[model samples]
Target: MEIITSGRLKNTIKYLRALFIIGLILSIFFMLGILGVLAYAKSQGAPPLAVPQTSLFYASDGSIIEESHRGQKRYWVPLSEMSPTIIDATISIEDRNFYRHNGFDYKRIAGAAIADIKAMAKVQGASTITQQYARNLFLEHDKTWSRKITEALYTVRLEINYSKKEILEGYLNTIYYGHGAYGIEAASKYYFGKSANELSLAESSMLAGIPKGPSRYSPYENLEKAKSRQKIILNSMVSNGYITKKEAEEVYQTNLAFFKSEDLGRERIAPYFQDAVKKELLTQTNIDEKTIEMGGLRVYTTLDPKLQKVAEEQVAKNVNPDSEIQLGFVAMDQYTGEVKALIGGRNYEESPFNRVTQAERQPGSTFKPFLYYAALENGFTPSTELRSEVTTFLYDDGNSKYTPHNFNNYYANGTITLAQALALSDNVFAVKTHVFIGENSLVNMAKKLGVTSDLVNVPSLALGTSTVRVIDMVNAYGVIGNGGQKITPVFIKKVVDHKGDVIYEAEQSKEQVLDPNLAFVTTHMMTGIFDAKLNDYTRVTGQTITNSLTRQYAGKTGSTKTDSWMIGYSPQLVAGIWTGYDRDERITLTAEKQYAKKIWADFMEEAHTGRNVTAFKPTEGVIGVYVNPDNGKLATNACPISRLTYYVKGTEPTEYCMDHVDHYEEVEEKQPEEDPDKDKGWFKKIFDWF
Candidate 1:
């Protein structure tokens, strides 16, 4: 009885032990299934993809300047819009069994395991598109067995949770192709300068092959390796029924039709203007520098390519090519104040300094217009005149006196009109006018014209003694061009984000800075300055043309020792030309009008070839009546000589030259010709006598 009981106990122990082993195996499998379910849920809902922001620029004509961003980036494209070649090539090269496998390819895994064991002796890696996305989106860039296992697990979960097409689309949008490229759309523009749908089979194959290793297979860096990779891709395409074998061979034989990394067209257009626009973009959008250079973006600008070309050619031709002296130019739309053409420096590579906004030089007589405007605003008219004579200033230090002279170094010998003084750029007349009106008025007027630099409130401010930038000067002139409204100079019209969303729209704020009548009066005075109306007293050769030979325009000439400036506006365009040394050295010993005016004329002639010749109408409160040179009043036959001056209504001279009765009579200019070979104007002879 005892032996039978012991046998039963031994049998029970064996059965219990067997049950324990079976349950352990079952529990292990069940835990794995639950983990798999959780992983699958996580993969199906991988965190939303991260995308970098890109900024784009546009011109006045609504053209792109620069797109700001950096990345081997993708632009989101719908499946319907994606090219069949692109879709097929990507699938063939990345994952042949992409459609058949759940995200994790077990067959590939087994093969890769054997390959890895063989490669562990060396080095090897095989990753499917889903696995790559899993790594790119969630995993670190670590090549560890643990990481590999996680990648496989996530890839499988991705397949279970997402559709084949959905996974493919997400992968395409999220993959990094080397050269800072991201998506198919971005890659298309970066490589081909077109949309992804427009990519050719050869182009698609080249792009498709980039996934193996973008840097290694980049056509730009290693064309031969890229071709080899392309061939492998082509074979896969052929085997997968994506393309015919003959077609693949033909494509393989053809030279890689790689583009010049996009923008072949932009290069052929306004490169300098485009560069300026980009600089403005850097300031407007706080994008990272690396992204701007590597991230492909489409920039639109406000430049007129045709005008930009003309402006460039004119500057290159007129300015000394080898001279380090920089020139800054800006052309704007009269109505909108959009900067159309700009040249920042002689060469961007040599000197990155932008003279347009950076350098501040005296506007010289250019400042007189603002003084005149102030006079007009404070109750003056185009017919108003100020006494043009020898005037000396009394300073706090009585011993130190200030006496201003005209360019010709002679007082008008008697009273002269304001129109004549401006046309002649007479320093004496302008200084007197500023004194009468008060210096602060001139400063305020200048500020109204967009002068941001400090203004020396001394008497010399009337002669453009304060420094101002070329851009500011041009913008001030634009006030007259646009009647009386002040339009802020706009280089960037709009900025768009990478998603084609408008991030910043241009706000071209314009406000009335001067009375319309005053602006007109100022323009009217400038017109005669260029019309040779003061020819008897001054030589205004550069802007002066025969009425029959002339196209209607308005302009002003300025000289301040080292610099010479000529700025003008036709009905169609406003342009300015400045000539000076970069070191502030005098370009010529003597201030000459010819150099600046010639450059201005040459540039304007070419710029306005196809454009209409427009006229500036005389605004109200301005009149074109002639005045006596010897007396500041409406001209008469009895007046031996006359000069026309424009003024605001009440500033017209109420009295003629009273202090100097014999001033005109005492003038002696009878000098025997010392050199018959020396050709001189009558005014030159007068100077020789002095």
Candidate 2:
């Protein structure tokens, strides 16, 4: 009786233990199922899949300048546009049960699980087409269990949200292939030198094998290994009924010709300029950086391809190639402030530091125009005379002393007119005017003329001791060239997304900031910088480029110990050039000193080849008069150095120059010549003199 009771109690305890084990297993599964459902709920509002497309930069005439993609070099194509063979090969090799599975193929999973259990590790993949697409689109390629679980949940969401065709299309267009390619089309071109739609069955099968292991399966990397992978793909294609056994064997036996051209490599067109455009796209528009690189944005830029080519050629031909000297060049439309062409550095491959919009160097005499413009607004004329001799100033209640000197420590040592002062880049005249107009006036004028750089209110600021960007200086010069109507630099004219919807269009902003008449007079005065007649103890800064110019131009040249700048414009265009070392080494080379001027001259002349020569028009308040460029006095036949100068109507010189009277009379007695303009009409003579 005792033994029977003990056996019955033991059986009862065994039954209870079995019941607990079964209940625990069921509870674990139920919790896992709840977590899976929650994950699906979380993915219900997943952001739509965004396939990266190359952002194309188009020139004003619709020519492609660059195809900008941050990382993935994908040329997106819909599945309908893809070749049927590539599709079939891809489907066969990547997932055979693709069409029948909802998200997970239970049969493949069970087989993979059995294999993993046999090996006591997770190695075999049971991912279907939907599963692989979900992983590629969103998740990382880590093989951790948590990652696998997340990938599974995402797979479920993708299957529930999208159709099979959409999933396959996204997968084909977003997968990585060898040789910097990211999609089927790019891979086709990179490997076969043909479009995806034009690929044959043999080409398609070979490409279909690369994505599994790019370096291991790429024909470019290893032909034998790629062939082996290709054979497997073709066998699978035959098994899947995509091709007959004989067709598969024929494709496998064909000795395929590989693409060996360099034409399809990444194009580097104006790399520095493209950097600036990308920056502007992020800051100026409502678009994000990712969208600019991957949303297939069509950016219609103000770039002039002809001018861009000319700019590059000029820089390459004129700049000293063997030296460490760097240069920056930018050409902009004066009327609209459209940036036409840009070169940011000497060599883009060696260094990508953009000097045009990034580096800020001392502008030197290029800043003089702003000071002189302020003077013109404050009761100063082109004929206003100032002592150009070396001088010291006592500003700040005579506590601070500043001495300004011209290049090479040379000076006129006598009175020079404002026109001649600018022509020779007389430092004394510039500082004197800066003080007279108050130290802060030039800074204010620069700000109004589209200068965004910081400017210190000091006496040397008149001499351009303050550093400024080449783009800002060029933009300011555009204002002067466009009759004082200030316009900001415009890099992109409009932008359109991939859907053909206009995203951003630049609005041309023009504001009347300076007096039109005074601006015209200032512009005319600048032309004297190239006129040899204005030469004094110091030669005109732009005299070196004078012979190279074909059309009428108003220009200024600026120099410091380490920087050389040339900013100038015609009626149609404005440009700036800079040359110096990145470390600000003192310029001792003669060629380095003149590089900016030569490049500016070459680019401007060639860019304006077919364009009509347009002369600057003076307002009604301004009048053109022949004056002694040396003294700014009314011109007489006696004056040896005379030029057609513009001035506000009342500012015209009434007194004729008497210094050359006796000199000319002595010359007349020795040898008299007929007056070239004596028989011409007034307007005709003025035009001919110019």
Candidate 3:
């Protein structure tokens, strides 16, 4: 019996020894496999840890205008700024053992692995706070073995590089909270219109329940589902001892007030200006779209909030609310080209099309100034006379014939000066002047003044037939307002990075595109529109637009069958207003409803309230001369009527009035030999002594 027992014991010992050897070999292989994975992770390099940040836009007065973001809206806040309730609730639900684990929960991972193996797919996620942070920062939320391995690798890096508080903070800030919100602060403000530090226990639990399935648990989307998740979170908080059972019960029963979904839509202020800034940033800088959206840039813009408010209010008050007629308003600094105020449409919520910079409509008579300016530059004075009779322009080898006349077919048939032609907005005179200077010259002049739209070089262009944008028209008129210095409109003044360093600063660009004398002469002619007793069509019909603002300003009124424009400027401010329908339909202006002029006058009057009235300065080489109103020539006392007209020194009419030769025949002509100063005028001789 003893020998049999010994044989059994020997067999048991042999089996035990063989089992020990096999276990040792398996352990060695596992260790080597882990070592290989660690080495591979080390060689693969660390994942990107830079967090996406929200960018802010500010007005000139340093007031926040808007906040912009890319794929996810995140407002990073330090852990101290977070309420203890939110931190506790998040920890209770996401990772109760977060403080004790190195980087992951191995027990939970094992359980999850077993469950996933049984299901033959990933059925559960055992990611701790640190692991989730790693995934949110660097990895994607994809369920795959390769993705899991990558997430695990990043998890170790995060724990090693950051502290426990930092890991928790990052996890809370980077987690998705739906509704375009990604962080605790953004979610708090989005859901409750308050800060995270002010969240109550109920609110914290409700917010904490969103990270698991934001869309499914969002109160805005599904109240019952969100309430159910909130209950689960409250129960977890109670189990973890973060809150008492009674407290949890009371908090769950507490009525939670939520922010309206429309509040998010209202967050965007001045949507049109915001869109313009975004486009300009992308086009003018080396920064890419992704960088601008997510790089946490602080953009200081040139928008004047006060002026913008006045513009919006004035437009709403003046335009017909029920009519489909749309209005485009743009105001800017004439010299610097800083856009002070802009209103692209009546209601940005209903329509997002920016008419200020996008829509192209004919300027009608408003374009006459550009033609006359071109003529002035090419040796024509303000007193240059042209016949205002009906004229036919044959273009394209006579394939097209354009018969031009004044507005309402009001023909002046006789001769008219350039100033009268512009004041009357005579199409026939404009066509004659356009033909005299050639079509390409006028187009080039408009281009230099900042008209970028397509301009057909036709005779009708003299009557503002070419389509142009309101912004371009405003900038173009600014050339005349700014004393001939070309200025391009600028929206963003500077762009700063998250570190408070200026990445981009606007350099004011100015070009001497036109002679200062020619600009002054053109401005002087434009002032004729305000002359109430000038007997022109605008005045004779009592459409005298500028009678409201009795200040010394220059402007022009334009109209087409479908569009109405009133663009004017003082020495300090330049504003343009356009009223028209989105579709090309006729807009009949009534006696009381002069939409464009009223809006322009209202906005300009408000804009110039506290500002000084500075007169347009005339440059050197320009002299004021009293000329015959009947015929554009040097006026004498014998002439029935005469007015002070400005002209370039050499371009003024040299000859005396010949139409009234009978009246002037009594006075002998002074020969050059008899009078040494015969060529100079009486005013010129008086100035020569000085």
Per-prediction backbone clash count:
37, 0, 0
| C-alpha positional error of residue 531 in candidate 1 after TM-score superposition, expressed in Å | 0.7
User: For candidate 1, what is the TM-score?
Assistant: 0.77
Kindly provide the TM-score of model 3 when superposed on the true structure, using C-alpha atoms: 0.72
| lDDT leaderboard ranking | 2, 3, 1
- lDDT of candidate 3 over 423-498, digit per residue (tens): 7777888898898988898899889989999999888988888899999999999989888897999999999875
What's each prediction's TM-score?
0.77, 0.75, 0.72
Note the Cα lDDT for every prediction shown: 0.70, 0.86, 0.83
List model 2 lDDT by residue over 514-574, tens digit each: 8999899889888888889888887888878888898889999999999999999988889
Residue 130, candidate 2: C-alpha displacement in angstroms: 1.7
List candidate 3 stretches off by more than 4 Å: 1-38, 50-73, 76-128, 138-147, 160-169, 177-180, 191-268, 271-305, 345-353, 393-401, 491-508, 533-543, 589-593, 620-690
- Sorted on TM-score, best first, the list reads 1, 2, 3
**lDDT agreement of model 3 with the native:** 0.83
